[model samples]
Each structure stands twice: as structure tokens, then as C-alpha cells.
Target: MWRDPGAPADSFYEIRPECTDVPKSRFRIKAGKTLSARKWHAAFSPEGYLDIGKTLSRIHRGGIHPSIRGEVWEFLLGCYDPKSTFEERDEIRQRRRTQYAEWKEECRQLFPLVGSGRFITAPVVTEDGQPIQDPLVLLENNPDGGAIVPPQTPQDNNGMGPPSTDAANKLEKMTDKGVIQWMLTLHQIGLDVIRTDRTLVFYEKKENLSKLWDILAVYARIDTDVGYCQGMSDLCSPMIILLNDEADAFWCFERLMRRLRGNFRCTDSSVGVEAQLSNLASITQVIDPKLHQHLEHLGGGDYLFAFRMLMVLFRREFSFCDSLYLWEMMWALEYDPDMFWLYEDAEETSDKSEEAKARLKSIRHYGKYERENMKNASKSSEEPPLPISVFLVASVLKEKSATLLQQARGLDDVVKILNDVNGNLDAKKACVAALKLHKKYLKKAKKP
Candidate 1:
């Protein structure tokens, strides 16, 4: 967590007047009887794109235009469906249904692998070397099951073979251990299955969202206790669509699920989400005190914008392709594919474990540096976090903060600031600024 800068309450930071000036002829103005005007008009029109379709493709093959950035971004991000033909749509639907069926079957088959057969008890070591309790035994075990010996008569209870207290303690201990192993097994297998599952990525069609929803619903049913949450689908949907290999995507999502399961624990309270939000708020306060103050004043500074990012791992804010790019970058930068599950200190005899641990520490250290660098870069650019929309919100204010401070008189001023940014800000620049702001906050948070 980071400390907030003690900025004066009455006065706020000001933007230089030079920063507020809109340049003359910022965008070329159309004039009657002008060739440039005619060219600009034609190029900017939606229908004009049809006329120079091949030419547009050729130019885009080299690079892309800023004018068509939004559509182009959507397309690149796999959120756009260029194949509008009837046959193509039907094919996508057919493939999607098949994928769902295949997923269901896979889950059914995988169930046995996760079940705890006749043994009914799995050994687990606690830090203190005491056997922990299991919840399943307490849940499913019944005195009527006939597995337990009959209780002694009142006369025999006066001198039973074993004391009732000892018997109860042993039962409780067994129950705890059973539940722990059950949970651990569920965690491990669930992660493995989700990580490997994959499906077609063409589910971005509005109608396909419901089908995608169904797939996630099935996962929730499989584990009703955890059920589903906002971010799980966001993470799973992309993998299903992009990989086109259900098993592969399932396992990948599974691996992610293992690490992230804590985020979705349905114990009635959202403690995990709150803690993350608090951390984000603290970081923001430390790095960009002015922006933090503005948000706090505006009633938007508790880091609510980060909720989706933290939950979905940045799926909603970025296009699917860009999200993948960012995710892969994050995974590569932060997690080691080869050294996963290697503990910091373990009594393993394998030589590879030693090698893995060294690599693990190096990667962990490197990830910290990379995260800090990324945060700094985003702040310098006055951007927000790529994974969270708040950075973009903060950037708009930062860029226009001076103007806003001068123009805004109170809460209405903040509202006006938000109003102006609604759909008017460039997503790319906003993303850049978000990254800059994150780094800036992180750096400030490190100060004594």
C-alpha cells in the first residue's frame, strides 16, 4: 500500500495555459471548391471505404490509419467479424455448439479423475505436523451409514473400550483432513482441466455471447460453491474462441483458475476484491496525488475501476487480441512456464528442482522490475493501467486537469470532466497514459 501525498485541501495543481490551447487548423477545415476538402470528405466517409477497399487493405498491410483506429482495433482484437456472409455465420454457430457439447463431455470424463474413491481419506501435512480436518466428512458422513460400530449401551458407557472424548477428537480430525484434501484435489484438477480447454474464438457475435454464457454456467454448476463471477467468463471466453482446441484452452484456464480461485471464493463477502482495490487506491494516491485527490473528491477514487481488471485479468478493457497480447506479455514477464509450482524452499531430491527454484526467484525479481517499469512508463505518459479503466479516467483528468480545475467549481465540475471524456477520449492514448500512471504510483509508493 502507498501513502497519499498531503496536498493542500483548498488549492489544487494547475495546468499551464499553454497546455489548454487548441491549435488553429488542428484538423483540416473543408472549404468550398477545394481539392483537399473533397479528398478528405471522400476518405472520411463510411461508403468511401468500400470504394478503396483493396487500397485500404494494402495500406493497412503496411500499417494502420489513426482515423479508422477504433474499427481497426476491434478487428485486430478479434472482436470484429469481417466474415459477414450467411454461410460463415452458420459455420461459426455450428462449431460453437459442437464445442460446448465437447466441453460437457470432457468435464464428465474428468470427474472420476478428481473423485476420492473408497479410501475416503487423503493425508495432508500441516505446518505444525498435525492432521487437519476435512469438510466433506462432516457434510456427507451419517451415523445411519452402517459404517460406524453401534454405540455401547448405558451400562457399557460406564467403562467403554475407548473414551467418547477421544473418539470425537479423532472424528473431527479425520473430517478436517478429508475436507482439505478434497479441496486441494478439486483445486488441482479444476485448474488442469480449465487450462487445457479450448474452443473457437468467433463467439463475439452478439448471439454467441449467450452460448458463451452457457459454457460458463456449466462450469459454475460443476462447482456450485464457487459458482461463477464477473471475471471468470471474461478470461474463459477468449481462450475458448482463440485456441479452437477445447482441451488446450480448458487446461490453460485451469492453470489460471488455480492461481486465481481465491478471487472467486463465495464465502458471502468480497474480501479479496476489496483488498486488491485498497492496494490500487493506495498506489494511486502515492504516485499521482493530484489525480487521486480529484478522484476522491469526485467519488471515483476507491479504485472501483480496477475491479474488472483484477477480476478478469484485463479481459474487458482490451480487445481480445490485445488482451491476449497483454496477457501473454504479463505471463511471460511475471510467471515462468518452465518453473511453475517450484517452491522457494523444498526438500526435493531432484537436481532440476534446484535449477527451477533459481529460475523462479530470478523471474519473480524480474517481474517486480518489469511491473515497476511499466507503471512508470504509463505515468510519464499520463496514461492509466491497461488492465483497468481507471487509469484512462485518471489520464483524461490529468491531461485536462488544469482546465478542469479552472473550469470546475465543485462536484458538477467533476461530472463535467467525466461527461467530456465519455466516448470522446482515444482508447490507445488512454491505454498509454494508464500504464504511465500505474508506474508513477508504484514508484511513489516505494518512498519512505
Candidate 2:
């Protein structure tokens, strides 16, 4: 994991047409600039803006519009063209499916040893103390024990008992944990495309949902102690799509799950969440201290709403294809900058102030939030580290801080503002902001 500490981190590259193959949909090219200019500057015209607006609107309406659906899906899947022959498509699908399946089995075996039942309900050490496991596989099996179990409580026989209120509260919290697990499992099963019905039910056609459930069940069996939870399905959705190969997806999800599994471990287990909230708070304070203070006053300091975004690495915000393109760009950047680091150096003596520690930490945190940590010791173990979403989020809030503080009255207002963002977001703008923040942090940390 520490092979390439000095790799130039590219998690903050600007998004342009060259990064993805999204066809000209609603966004239009401006009059003054050539396509080359637009690519170089990451610029798009007002017509382009309107198109993004339309795409987002369609998204909010519960589906990508038919006109742009193919482009959006293709882009999300990173499929530049639908020109593949039936045999080719089948081959690709089979490869992905096999990858997901094998990884799912691996994770199932490991989860039991790490989770071990009541330990999940109450734990001492995090699974991280052990070697990191495959996320795609872990994701296939539910992290929480399968099937819902109500909270357990010890009773006092001497005409006294733990307060019913306390018991109910604990049960509710436990239920939430179960819900999140379920969500991750659903996501792992590739049920992320929100349906036109507005229902969160899984698709049962051709035993698709069952396959997802089966995959999740394997994870559950590994850690039957931590069983299924709801929101977890949401976290697993992008993995299923990206891996397309079940074993690969299962392994990738398992890797992701190792870092993120703590998020829903138990009520007492909130260190991961708190760390993320702190990062968010730090960004707001560093970029716009005044707005940060105002939000803090409004109790926005808790930053609860941002939790989902952090957990899934912006999957909820961008289209799946867009998210993958953005991720691959970051990966490419990390790889390009540090291709040799894995083999050459075992350690670095650089001062923390000059090192990539914080930037690296930032990416880890964002990926943790996104639940997209890929820790496979590939042939090139020196992969560059990049966390593009942090840059994106920081840029967005920086761009809107003044307006948000001016118009909104409190923390609730801030949450509402963020939620309304829908899909009117500018990926390129966010990418630019991320780059700026990366530079800012690097400069601030430079040794005096």
C-alpha cells in the first residue's frame, strides 16, 4: 500500500469530453470556442448547461430521458459505443460475472473470522487490524448477519428493567444498521438504477434480485454476526455495475467494505463517521471560514446529511458512467505520477509538511465515504492515490458558500440547498475546485 508515496496524485483532474465518451446530448458547444478549446479549458456552452439541466431533471423524474438514456448509461458504464457484437457483449458479461462470483466466495470465507457474531454487535478491534479483504466479494455477502434481528437487551428480574424508551431507541438504531446493510447488498446486486415507480424494491426478473440477495447472503454468512442492513444496498449498487463480473465486483466491493464496514458496525462504532464529518468541517472552515462558522452555529457542524455522499464516493450525485469516468481519470493520474514508486522505495524521509500524507489521507477519506476503496495489490502496487470527490465537493461548496449563507437561514437551510442540487452540477467545475484545494493544502503543508 505504501509502495508509491511520491506519485503525483491526479485525483483532481478537470473533467472534459476527452475523459468520457458521452455524446452531444443536451449540453451544446459554445459559439466562440472550437471543440479543441473546449476540451483544453473544459468549457461547455449555455446550451450544454441546459442539457445537463434537462438530464438532471429527467433523473429527478426517476429515469434518464429516452433521448439521452443510452448516452447516460453508456457513459456511466464507460461504454463508448453499443457497437459490440452479441458474442462480444456476452463474453464481457461472462468475464465480469465470473470475477464477481469468485470474489464473493473469498469474502464469505473471510467475513466469519473477522466479524464473529456478537462481536459485530459489540466489538473490540476493527477488521482493519487484519489484512484488507476484497470489497466486491464482501459486498456480495451481506456485512450484517442476514435477516433482521431486533435489538437484544438484558432484563432485570427484581421488578426493574432497562427503560422501555431506551430499549426502543436501541432497537431503532439497530434497525438502521440492518437497513444500511441491506442497501449495500442491493447496490452490490446492481439494483442502483432507480425505477420509474419511486419504490426502492429490488428487481426480481430472471432472479436478478435473488442473485443480488444471494451475493449479499454470502457476505452475511461470513459475518452472520453483522447480518443484513438496508442502506448498504445503495453502497453496493455502483460496484455491481462497474465490475459487471460478479467475482471482480464482489472482490472490489469486499475491499471497499473493509474500510467502510465500520460505518454501520454498531451505534458505538462511529469513529469512521466522525472522522469524515471532521474533514467536511475542515474544508468549510479552510475555504470559507465565515460560512463555516454560520453553519456551525446552525448545528450544521454535525454534517449528518453529508454522510451518504461520503459513504458512496459521490455515486448518488453523478450518473454511474460519469462517476466511473471521473474515477478512472483519477486512477490514471495516480498511476501516471507514481508508476515507479511501488518497486523503488520502501520509505520516505520527507517532512509531513512536504509529503503527500494529507492529500493521500484526503483521498482515503473520500473513498471511504464513497465506499470505493480498491486495495488490490496489483502488479503495479505503486498505483497513484487520488480522491477526486473531495476536490469536487470542496469546489461546489466554495462556489456556492457566499450565496448559501446569504440566502439560507440555518443548518436545515444548508442541507436543503445541497439536496436540491439534483443533477445541475458541473463536474468540470468541481474538478477544477478539487485541483485548487489540493494545491492549497500542499502549499499550506510545505516545510517552512
**lDDT per residue (tens digit) for residues 256-280 in model 1:** 6655666677565564566556755
Per residue, candidate 2 scores C-alpha lDDT tens digits across 127-204 of 223221222122222224333212232320111111133222222222234433532342222222221111212231
TM-score of each: 0.43, 0.47
How many backbone clashes are present in model 2?
78
Query: Where is model 1 poorest over a 10-residue stretch in terms of lDDT?
Result: 113-122
- In candidate 2, what residue range of length 10 has the lowest lDDT sum? 155-164
lDDT of 2 at 94: 68
The parts of candidate 1 lying over 4 Å away from their true place are 1-201, 204-218, 221-225, 266-271, 313-316, 336-339, 342-352, 359-439
